[model samples]
Target: MAWFSDAYHFEKSQLTVAHVTDCHLFKDQSGEYFGVNTAEYFARCLAAIAEHQVDCVVFGGDLTQDHSRDSYQLFAKLIADSPLLCPVFWLPGNHDELQEYHAIAGPHILSHKRITFQGGQLLLANSKGATPAGWVKQAHLEELSKGVDDTPSVVFCHHNPLPINGYLDKHLLENGPQLLNALVNTHHCIALFHGHVHHDYKYAFRGLNIYATPASSIQFTKQTTQWQQEDLGPAFRLITLNFDDTHSVQLTTDVVWLNG
Candidate 1:
């Protein structure tokens, strides 16, 4: 972790968080998706994350491809075996069953949708819908309003809250405008993090940074009419929150690719 600090700004009281998403692990360890070995790739990503020694880690969803109890158990075991010495948080993706996740995830999982640090708050919402698409319900928005305060915050969910174009747009969050309205009302949010896109992306929505991380298992090609995999390998985002003299926090993000 100290070895990697030179690549990014480090300040006193700064919180470093590693974000990994869309592992898409299958029940069988040897299972391959689109000619890529997902489980092996995910393992390598975890090994890379361990080197960062982050304060905490967040799994941004799509934790499983088979949606089986075995898959979640395997995921738990992998994390347990890893060298990450911090709290772990996770949410459900479209492929996941919330109830099953709750049962397997146990206590480390966030019961409420928010976590507060000395400098800022981390808010999470469930966006998975009945179909493959997603929706941030009105109730979720209300919850977000209650959780957010004066502190700069980052919101995390499984689906992209804004459209990115091409075939992916068809499966975007259905009530994205409503979700954005809710976020706008918060007023203190600095960024929004999500998965499901399976590629690295950064954009701004109403002055807030919207970041989408590449999947831990595979990378997706952008601006395609149909699903396609990029030749690149797995990656994760390293986020740092540094406070200024006025106690205001500044957020910075860096993407770490396992194979380049």
Candidate 2:
């Protein structure tokens, strides 16, 4: 429940961040999951991200499929060998084990949980609890509440704080209402980002924008009552935060598909 503060000043008018999630990587590069070659797709997504010139990269979780030490090692190696060239921060998704991920990506881990860029801050909280579903601990909520200040901020977590309907809703954050209530009271949070649904989604709740990025390996069929895969290729999100003269921040997000 400690907040790690890493602050940086950017001269640019806007800060560019690449959001990649749900990699579901395996130890073997050739291993496939749900008919998708996750390692291959993740590599392609990383290549796409390299071209963006992002200031930083934020991983929205589900970093592994097998939850093995090798899986975490492979992920760390891929990122180390990639050309993204920026600070990478990651949170654990439902499919990920924190200890295993932290053991490998210790330096790059998002456990410190907050990053400052220009006039805005990106606050990441762990929503993974004792179950596959999401739950925000009271300590995390208190940390978030205390972290808010005059700067505009966006929160990132592994689970959707709000339901997306169908099968996904069943596993949505059980205490999402409490989380939302805490956020709404902050008055400085502009948006929220999450993974796990494996599909792209955008909505507004209590005046805060809620975004869900597609999985880097596979996408789930939307509006389905049961588990099903979508035919869509892997994708990632590029988010740009612009600051006005009043220090008000505006965000624009674009989902990039790696089909080629």
Candidate 3:
């Protein structure tokens, strides 16, 4: 990860969000990714988040390890059985089949939408492109940028727009610089959140804060040039957004590690 956190953030908020990403699930419920049962871990994650009274949940993509229809079906079933009562939103990751995922997914995935909360709204940028690397079309970028203005806002996607200077750096969003510039230009943008690096990362560019939530499946080693996984449990990011009548938002973040 390119950034650091000296201490955990806060304890209370108006709009609380749980961001779960990089599930890498399989068709079989007992499937594992590097010894971690992806499906079970994801279920554990949802169970843990259910305790928090979150206003919404954002699945940051890569729902399937094998990109199979059965995998997506399992994903749909899990959420259907999940105790989480909040609104759910999702986007495509590098491994996600952008072209066929919608049809293949038993429960149709929603189109690009916003998660509106008390103070402002959350925008999703589709960074899924031609390969493992990310690419957002100029038209879509412009559309996403238009939503952020004087109102406090946050952006979510699947790829890290900036590199973490590790093996994942090679898979950084291809046109990420432009994407960053688009969001940066939105002075009211509060932060950008994503997954794909498989590690918790925090970054700031041109005053726009960014974060990468840990995967619900496996955790990756940070700051290493080589590929590696850490002995860690399934996890997700808890974002507490406190807003004022002035339409500005204050955010505090914490990652909830499950006992999987």
Candidate 4:
């Protein structure tokens, strides 16, 4: 898990985005684990975001602990109840069901399309259905490759294209090379964001910035001898983009402690 300060610089723009992922929301109101309620922690995380004024929100994936319609309903309601005025963009997680999530979460969830017309271009690609690992379809890649201009483009998905030093590293996108091969070939994209490792990570690949946000509920210690979820600290990310004919991006780490 790694975090970088002032990761990138962009032109001045009022557009700000909050990135939250892997909520793993559950149906039980008790929000309990081993008979102890965990709902308080969930509430705390949501409440903490009220302090930030963002133009949009991006949920990277893993929206439910159990892939149930009820869980998606709760997640939808949670967003509706928030005081945020920003639009939301969602990508699927390994835990999410595409048909059910789209039915319940509405049209904000993205897949194989360019979603924004203002500030810059935001693209959401589907990479959740690959076996042995996640994948980006060739047709989708072809569309995505041509979608953005020299303007800064931020793409979101559920699978990480880069490998981290841990258990999940092996489970990364099965066709990452193909996807990245297209991305680099495009020469217009600024960064790629995703979730699934439940850890904060960023790596530069051939000039493209690839990043993954930590889980909002819990974080897993990476490259450890034994697999365990530790409080690397619950957190989110803030992305502000500045663009024109050419583009640049800035990412800030927002850490929200469950105790507060």
lDDT (0-100) at residue 55 of candidate 3? 69
The numbered model that scores best in TM-score is: 2
Per-candidate TM equals: 0.90, 0.94, 0.89, 0.82
Task: Judge candidate 2 at residue 10 and give its lDDT.
Answer: 55
**Predictions ranked by TM-score, top down?**
2, 1, 3, 4
TM-score of 1: 0.90
Segments in model 2 whose C-alpha atoms lie over 4 Å from true places: 5-13, 106-111
| Model 3 stretches with alpha carbons more than 4 Å out | 1-13, 98-112
The regions of model 1 sitting more than 4 angstroms off are 1-12, 106-112
Q: Model 4, range 1-260, lDDT digits (tens) per residue?
A: 01111122223454567778888777865564333333444455555565677666777878778666787777777766766555566777777777766676454333324545445566777788646368877777776776654645778877888777876776788787778777777776778888888788888788887888877776778876356776544577777665444334444444445443
Q: Report the Cα lDDT for candidate 2.
A: 0.82
Cα shift from native, residue 227, model 2 (Å): 0.9
The lDDT values for all models are: 0.77, 0.82, 0.80, 0.67
lDDT of 2 at 157: 88
TM-score of candidate 3 to 2 decimals: 0.89
Per lDDT, the best of the predicted structures is 2
**What is the C-alpha lDDT profile of model 1 across 1-260, one tens digit per residue?**
11111111123457888889998888887877777777878888778888888877888888888878888877877777766666677777899887777776543343445556666777767888988899876777776666565767788888888888746677788987777767878888888899898888888878878899889887777888687787478899999987767888889899998775
What is every candidate's alpha-carbon RMSD to the true fold?
A: 6.2, 1.8, 6.6, 6.4
Clashing pairs in 3: none
Ranking by lDDT: 2, 3, 1, 4
